[model samples]
Target: MRTSDAQTLIVEKNPNPVADSERDALLLNPVFGRVFTDHMVTIEYSRERGWQNGKVRPHAALQLDLATLVLHYAQEIFEGMKAYRLPEGGSTLFRPGANARRFRNSAERLAMAPLPEELFIESVRALVRIDQKWIPGGDGAALYIRPFMIATEAVLGMKPSAEYLYCVVACPVGSYFKVGSPSVTLWISDQYTRAAPGGTGDAKCGGNYAASLAAQAEATREGCDQVVFLDAVERRWVEELGGMNVFFVFDDGSIQTPPLTGTILPGITRDSLIVLARDMGLAVREEPYAIDQWQEDALSGRLREAFACGTAAVVTSIGNVKGRQYNFTVGDGGAGPVTGRLKDALLDIQNGRVEDRHGWLDRL
Candidate 1:
């Protein structure tokens, strides 16, 4: 195992790990977030002694007190990233620095102790190196890495905890959605609001996701793949989906997505696509879009395509949208050419199939 100069990580190998054959069989059908690797990384923090006791240990359940701060106050934040297998050999991380910075920002927003960027990157790198075998190959497959922080102080109150625990765990995943389904249906939610102004929408925290579950359940009941939220002010402006950021392709060779006005998560994948689209000579705008306008444009043949992007789902086209009073289809109800091209460009950079001009790939 390799150790970075920033921190010396003590490694404790998992005893009685699964046998090689069983592990291979399990890897044959890797489910997202279901089958985890044998080891995990943990680092403790406190007001007295900043960050300490960084180590790689066997994957196991955490022992928490009955009145933990995170359980009560929800002072927690997490990041999602992946380690892709290189075409020639080994594996590499895609834009870990960006994830680290975002994690810090989330911690700041949640009033939790901010983790050092180097430590965050080193922790993720250590886990990936130790569990490199868990990384699946081919398209739509990689080792999904989750780095998270929690307020672990036992004396819970209405304030942030004095102690914290930062951990990293990984699981091999095949695909976020069904392989054959290149496009997905969405339910425009009017009864629920994902985040309000001056909320934690820009932070990658669990509370935001928990709040969106009701709307997601409503979408599920409506027989839709996901739920798209409108703005909380008027419930008319298009915001984002439950977990992924959305994009719109116009017939006039331009792209539009909801602006980040402190009510939407600044997705790394979303930013990457914006840059990739601009590189391809397409005008991209971060502006507010209304649900009524979306339906009107789709119906009038002005909206060419719609799609969502994230770390897990990559890029997924929006085929059909359904609401209580309206329904519409985008671009023949299928994936459009621009959506395909952008998806391929972004995926190619992540998978090392194209030149990484932005210095995003961190080779291991």
Candidate 2:
């Protein structure tokens, strides 16, 4: 019933939505980030017009400028969130408005254009309203929405572009972690740090992600699911994973994570878990947890659990962290009690199985 930015958009429905049975098969084994929803939302920005030409059009290859700033300087930013289909007929957006707010923050940090919070949330609403059928309502499945912005100027300057474009693309995806949310092995990279002091680590940009691919590839070579980066200067503090934020639950019922120290992605799910844990009478501290603590705690059983959280994975229990000199495994090397409970509690609130205590669910 609550609508925000509908005034700016021009809706054009997709003529060819993926057929139901075919879509169902994709949902059954939905490969992450491969398939897409029928439509995408778009808005163009220029120095003169500001933000205009907002539309929801069919998803297809974009005709981009050859000298686009995004192509050359990689002036692009993105946010990832999901829309769940409730047991009732209607669909729901899980804290998508939060994502929109973060996207604006990212834009401001990038010196790119800030999508007005109302416009950002409204574009999502219109697109989801039209493409409600694509939302996978079954078990561990939902429609993943990727809202992105790119510098679209035809000029070949090294500076920020005068023109930019923003869009939201949806994909129906199954659980990000296969094997039913099992523990993941993390390959710690002392070689390439993800974010430096006052760097793009706090912002969700392509370069930060592009900078991690080689480290991620090395992680894959070691038979690990993901890569965790250390602080750029010291390589001592735990920063964040390539795509998610890290959390450690201690045996004493106190939860600690790497504080927002200008060199990490402040994930929305990470923020939610902090609130959720505190609501359940757990002490959650957003402090700089050293890597030595991770190893020592795991060795002593004091580190009860380790999990990664993001829009994609939701919550994945970490099995082991392998560095060059040492390798550590925690809590039977699988999903621990705290990890399981947190995942279920978050899911229940999103799926409408429980009450929306924090007002995160927005029904479509």
Candidate 3:
């Protein structure tokens, strides 16, 4: 276990890697999260020793005790990011430091040991360097990076885990949703609330996503591509989608989204778009939007477009919205000009197609 001086991560090459030909085949048109690279990164953490023994090894199954704390208590957090293949023949991570900061915040909220921000970023970069060959080319394709931490302490008592495992894995993935779709329909989840003001709503933890599955399933039954949740208290203000933050474009060229008042996730993509929109001389508002107002505005031509933003799905336009009592379409029910412009601005910066004026990309 020789330590890497540059990043302090120990490197171990895979003994039996997949053939290049086979890897190329898997990279072609791979489904999201289905095809993985050959190597992964892991680091152990303890209350006493802190973080140590970081390693880059072959990807394999994790051996956890039957009574692991995460299995019982669900003290887990994760981040989703991508490594884009540059046109000039290298790879880079998009705003990984932001993800690292979010990961630390989630850890603090969950009472888990927080991995250092530098370690988190380096762990991801190390894996990307080792598995650079697995990065795929083509529109909407990149190496999807998943960095997660789980409570590994084998205790049944209801307390924070004293030990944890941080792991980073990479997978070759295409579009998260159907590719080339003009837009997607969303179902309003009146029966379910994603998170409350006092809960883990703002944290990017596994439990929050676990709690949303039921509502997501309900949306699927209703023939919608995704679910949009309302606030828990009033149940009237629109909050966000099942796994993404939402934005609305009004006819006056102003955009608004739900405020991060302890209930919203404060998405990196959401933050980036806000910055980009402001740079482009557009008004971006962080405030609450009501469901009734949304429907009424769309019908009256005041609401020109609606879209959801996140790391997984990027920026996806909301063409149609439906609830129990009402259904409406925004501006002819297709991707709007504002949505397209924001998506293009984001994608261009991410893929290195334009100047990275904001210094968002971290090249490997």
Candidate 4:
């Protein structure tokens, strides 16, 4: 259906909502991606009817057929975003339009029906408005919103499904990583590659993440927090982390990230930082970064800092790197000055502590 038609969505409140006291207790220390809100948004699509039956309903399990296309073929895509409780006692979203566009791109790549950008934004807004109370007001805490689409047709064919389901759910969350060190260590994987040329690497689909589990486990076994993957072709050029994009700060007062060449997900957070860094008078360059060069620069004091950016983590400093053959530290094995500055700048804009000159905030 058209976006205008989606404006008149049906509302169905949850009958057994969480109690205030219980919810408050949960919010006091809401773990990331665990405690969910009360309601969820859903919209269905079919070849004949298109998108219809848009509604906000109670969060519950879906009864799908055993032969569902998505269950077998993995025709699914999703987006990650957050709703922040502003300092002035209101709510806002950070560049949700960008997320909408990326969601459409991902849907197209997966051969699924693309939901209108307005419909995607409106669905997220509707759910956040209904469950606004679930938003945490503590430091570094906000409501995490997840929007996804899946093929729901009851068939086992190798083609795209004729039916689809689009859904949005929210949960209160704190830091994605534990609050211990100001920087995180990464393990580079030479054995597994994240994406190859002309693959689904640019799409934010479930399959890309599923393919990284083995590498991620290898990182964990190596006593590291996260895994950094390289390009599949050369296995030398740095691509990105499992779920986030990577950036390197050179000693020459410039910033560099791997170019978006259909082998890396175009992250909204990464885009924001590029603008913000430029605003701070730092030259930002999108180019190929070799893993060997990364280690060489780090050890030779040419690379000053490095960080990973995404909707969930925001900006996290990468202190050290460990590979099968080489080991090195980034700028004294701690959060560098540039990394801290960039993190604070971005957070200030997101949490409403500074002026949003770029008009990235959408109030609700």
Superposed model 1: Cα runs more than 4 Å off: 1-6
| lDDT, model 2 | 0.87
Q: Give the runs in model 4 whose Cα sits over 4 Å from its true position.
A: 1-3
The local lDDT score (0 to 100) that residue 97 gets in candidate 1 is 95
Clashes of each: 0, 0, 0, 0
Model 2 lDDT-worst window of ten: 1-10
lDDT of 4 by residue, 1-364 (tens): 5556966679999999999999999999999998899999999999898889999999988889999999999999999999999988889999999999999999999999999898999999999999999999877899999999999999879999999999999999999988867888899999998888898999999999999999999999999999999989888899999999999999998999999999999999999999999999999999999999999999999999999999999999999899898799999888888888999999899899999999999999
Give residue 342's lDDT in candidate 3 (0 to 100).
94
lDDT for each residue of candidate 2 in 142-238, tens digit (9 for 90 to 100): 8888889999999888897888888899888887877554799999998998889888888899999999999999999999999998888888888
In candidate 1, position 94 carries an lDDT of 93
Worst 10 contiguous positions by lDDT, candidate 4: 1-10
Clashing pairs in 1: none
Question: What order do you get sorting by lDDT, best first?
Answer: 4, 1, 3, 2
54, model 4: CA deviation in Å? 0.3
TM-score of each: 0.97, 0.96, 0.98, 0.99
- Cα lDDT tens digits, model 3, 44-63, are 88888778889999999999
Cα-lDDT of candidate 3: 0.92
Local distance difference test, each candidate: 0.92, 0.87, 0.92, 0.93
lDDT for residue 308 in candidate 4, whole number 0-100 = 94
